[model samples]
Target: MLAGKRVLLIIGGGIAAYKSLELIRLLQKAGASVVPVLTRAGSEFVTPLSVSALAGHKVYQDLFDLTDEAEMGHIQLSRAADLLVVAPATADLMAKMAGGRADDLASTLLLATDKRVLAAPAMNVRMWEHPATQRNLATVLADGVRVVGPNAGEMACGEFGPGRMAEPAEIVAAVEAALGAGPLAGRHVLVTSGPTHEPIDPVRYIANRSSGAQGTAIAAALRDLGARVTFVTGPAVVPPPAGVAVVRVETAAQMLAAVEAALPADAAVMAAAVADWRVANAGAQKMKKDGSGRAPALEFAENPDILATVSRGALRPRLVVGFAAETEAVVDHATAKRLRKGCDWIVANDVSPATGIMGGAENAVTVISERGAEVWPRMAKDAVARRLAQKIAEALQ
Candidate 1:
């Protein structure tokens, strides 16, 4: 999405400063040339040589370097790029920006820049919640500086809260959004992922082998295309992608509710492996052996058909896609499922033991629609996701 853009990246001081290197690589891969600037404190964490090598440019450090001043002044340097990105935007740096302090090259550039600026804040939880920092945040936001994340999680100090810097991929999404790139821009897509667990009891439950790899890849691909994604996920081995609104659920009924709440979307991809049944007469405590040599009788109840519900709902999206993981009759079953579910399309795949697709990294899918079934070659799940995202963009367009 960032084909011809130039980005000015400022690496600030913090343990998270190391992520700036990955950010540089991602920006470069997205077709943007990066001009890196390292702050004095930032230098202590990552060397200028490392940043320069990754960015493929000289790392700017001093505000008053005579040679740099002779070639391109700070003002020119500030306005040179289309956007300025501050990674590991320390509390101190944010305070400086808010108070109009220009004691260093990084702050000076931020002050002189006429271009858009995006900051990724990273700090201790208490410091982030501090009144001074909050006030600074408010001031910078009022000044029209874009911010990405300080996601809640465990910290380097053995503490936990919303003080972690956003992952590199998340920052890239924010950049794409800021630049207004990608075909899916201004579009909203809902994605359901993972396998739901139907509780037989508090400790034991019925589950599946789904790793959520495909679904996670799909969400990331959609985000990269500039779509605002709402990811409703079940308990799975894979982690949800960053830069998307995530709603986590554990049962088919809960997944359906989350999907409904995320309504009015342009499109929806139902990729979750929701269990078909639940124990209707589950025991309050763990079921114990009675020594009768007979198993306990458990009644089975059907789970909510999420795809069908969405397709027939009043707030149905423009396009509804479902997934069918079958061990037999994959094509025939998927084609019938498309009609039965009333969805626009169904992506069917074989997940038999021999296929190794149940929890594998690769996928071979057959996309069934009213038109016909189109078989796709087996490939990495990520590649499949990118292709599907592109198709969704085209369909939406």
Candidate 2:
């Protein structure tokens, strides 16, 4: 997918900077020409000679090198690439990008580049989770920068959490997904996944059995098809897919807000298993049992119906799909739901205990549309997602 592409790769300072060498080799193997830019601190880990040798190009480092300035101006160098990638994007680098600081060659190129940028963050666990770093991340994301991972594992600091940079293969895959051309190219799709948690008290809440595997698969499939996806997900056991804009939320109301914020898409898939009701009279603290042995009175309120709202909203997409996980009469209930919710289609599955479909790897689904129901045989959720994504691509076309 990256054939004939020009990638301006900025190597950031971190132990993960060593991985950028492998990333350069992988990018070259994928048929992309890499222009290396090494940061001052980055040189401590990987030498510019090795980077330039692997990339087969001059490594750019100084912002005011007279020879570089005379040969090719910074503006041209920055704008010449199809995409800019920052491997091992340290917290400091990300903060600089967010704050628009251009004190160095790398940050200057990032600031001057008009092309899309992708970052593979690497930092300490505490640094990754810091509020300032998270704010900077959110800022960069809102500015259209794509992120791959700071996956969870043992860190070089002897700490374990989410701060490791993504593997070279994963970064390459994300680069391909970012630059790929396919049926859904230039399209934007919104997807919701997982189960919302309705807080009942400080220590307890109500949730469902949704693992978010199917929805994650669907988002990845859409991304592979070249669509820009906004994945609004609730508290899910399964992590979200790469190469998509992810918005995490805890409650149904928060999910609804996130969904609404990511509006005016070409298509929307409401795959979340939202709670039907929430505790209206939730306790400020954990509700304690009285000595009389009677439970406290709890008031219930209806949660927002995301599917129906998205389908009927003013900014509704051309195609709005919903999912129905029913225990009985799945097809009938799903068909009725499609009509009642005013959605274009409903992907329904029987999630009874006997089926073991919910939170399971496999799925047996029925697609309900205006024409009727089309039953599909049991298969892996990934397969289901690919088929459905193809259908969505066709519909959008």
Candidate 3:
């Protein structure tokens, strides 16, 4: 999708700087010509020589290099690319950009550039959540600068929480989404993701293996296509995309309520693995293991089907998509599910224990519509989401 695009890649100083090298390789593989801009501190983590070697171009680092400046002024250099990407965008750089401080080459180019700029922040959890950083992020977003991720996870410093940089592949996809043709602009898409938890007690609950990756990806992809997305997600490992309205819920009932609230959207993608059943009468406190050796019986009640509910609503969306994850008879079961659910389309995939597709980086899906079923080749989940988003855009047209 990025073929022939010129990417001005600015590497910042952070532990995640190493990922920039792989990002360069991926960008080039997708037919993009990368121009490397290394910050002074960025040079410390990854050498300019290494970046140049991977990028297949001379790396630009000095702002005062008279020879280079005379050949291509900073103003010209800044506007030379289709997009400016900052990977491992440190807190310091973000602050500078947020405040319009152009002390270094990277910040200077960022200020001088007219092209769209996307940043993937990498920092400690505390640093990311600090009021100063938060304020700066707000300023940049208001200024039309795009932000990708500082995903939540274990940090390199042994501290666990948010603040990890997005993976190279994810960054690439974000870039494509940013630069791709916007066919879904002005469209409103609502998506549900993750596995809903049905609590039996304070300490116990029922859940599934859904990581919410696919659904979140779909939301991001739709956002990239210029659609305003309302993402209704359960407790998910991955963070939702910026520039989208995110509604968090924990149980199937909560998810249904949130989805209903986000109605009148152009489309709805029900990718959440909502619990089939919930505790009939959940206990408020934790159940104690009594000395009596008898196991307690738990009563169950069926949860609402979010997809079917939305499909049958008075304000039904123009297109409704649902997911069916099955171990056996994948296509057959998925096709049956599409009819029963009354959704316009169903994305079916096998998530058996042996496949490891569930909560994995890749997926193989069969798209079932009113016409028939079509199986897709195994690909990254993000790619699958993009293809599906594009299909939705086409259908809308």
Candidate 4:
């Protein structure tokens, strides 16, 4: 999608700066010409020689180089690219951009550029969550600047939360999405993700091993295709993709509420593994482990089925896709699920412990529609998502 595209990459100073090498390579492999502008702090982590070697071009690192200025002025340099991308966007750099401080080459280019700018933030979790940083992020978003991760994960610091920059491949996908002509442009898509929790007590809950990778991938793919995605997700291991609206929930009831609120979308993908039952009378406080001779018996109640409700709603989506994770008779069960849920299609995958599909990178799935079932070979979750997004686009057309 990026063939013949010009990507102006700005590498910021952070531990995650190393990933920019791979990012440059990926962009070049995808036929993109990369022009790298390294910040002074960015030079401390990765050498200019290294970036120049990988990009196969001279790396620009100054705001006032006589030779550079004589050839192409800073204004021309800033406006030369189709898009501006910042990897490992440090907290300091983000704050500078938010406050319009163009003290250095990178920040100056950011302020001078008229092209769309995208950033993948990397910082300590605390730093990312600081009130100042939060305010800066809000300002950047409000200004129509596209931001990717700063995803939640174990950080270089011993602490863990959302502060990691997205992987190189993921960032490349985001770049392509930003630059590619959106196939589903101007469309709104609603997607649900993760395994809904059913609380039994304050300290205990029932849930499944849905990492939400598939759902997150689907949302990203749809965004790549130019769709405005509203992601209603449960407690997902992965963060929602960039440039999309995310509504977070934990339980089936909360998921239902979120889904209902994101109504009238062109399509809905019910990819969440919602719990079928919840405690009839959940304890408000932690249930003590009393030394009772007899075990406590708990009552169970059915939870709302989000897919069925949406499929049968008055504002029914034009395209409705559900997921069926089964251990046996995958195709049959998925077909039955499509009929039972009244959805237009069902994506069936074997999540049995033996298959290692859940919480894993690769997936083998069969997409069952009213026409028939089409089994896809095992592939990366992102590939599956792209294929599904294309299919959805065709269906919408």
Clashes of each: 0, 0, 0, 1
User: What is the Å distance of residue 69 in model 3 from its true position?
Assistant: 7.1
Q: What does each candidate score in C-alpha RMSD?
A: 10.1, 8.1, 8.0, 7.4
Full ranking by lDDT: 2, 1, 4, 3
User: Which residue window of length 10 is worst by lDDT in model 3?
Assistant: 177-186
Give all TM-scores, in the order shown. Answer: 0.65, 0.61, 0.68, 0.69
Off by over 4 Å in 3: 1-61, 66-83, 86-104, 111-116, 119-181
Which segments of candidate 4 are over 4 A away from where they belong? 1-65, 79-82, 85-115, 118-180
Q: What lDDT would each prediction earn against the true structure?
A: 0.90, 0.91, 0.89, 0.89
Q: For candidate 1, lDDT tens digit of each residue in 56-129?
A: 99999999899999988999999989999999999999999999999999999999999989899999999998
Q: Which lDDT tens digits does candidate 2 get at residues 1-397?
A: 6789999999999999999999999999989999999999999999999999999999999999999989988889999999899998999999999999999999999999999898999999999989999889878977888787766678999998778897898688668767864578899999999999999998899888899988988897788678999999998987786568999999999999999999999999999999999999988998888799888888999999999999999999999999999999999999999999999999999999999899887799999999999999887686688679889999999
lDDT of 3 at 271: 92
In model 1, residue pairs whose N, Cα or C atoms come closer than 3 Å (at least 3 residues apart or on different chains), thus clashing, are: none
Instruction: Give the candidate number with the greatest TM-score.
Output: 4
Q: How much lDDT does candidate 4 score?
A: 0.89
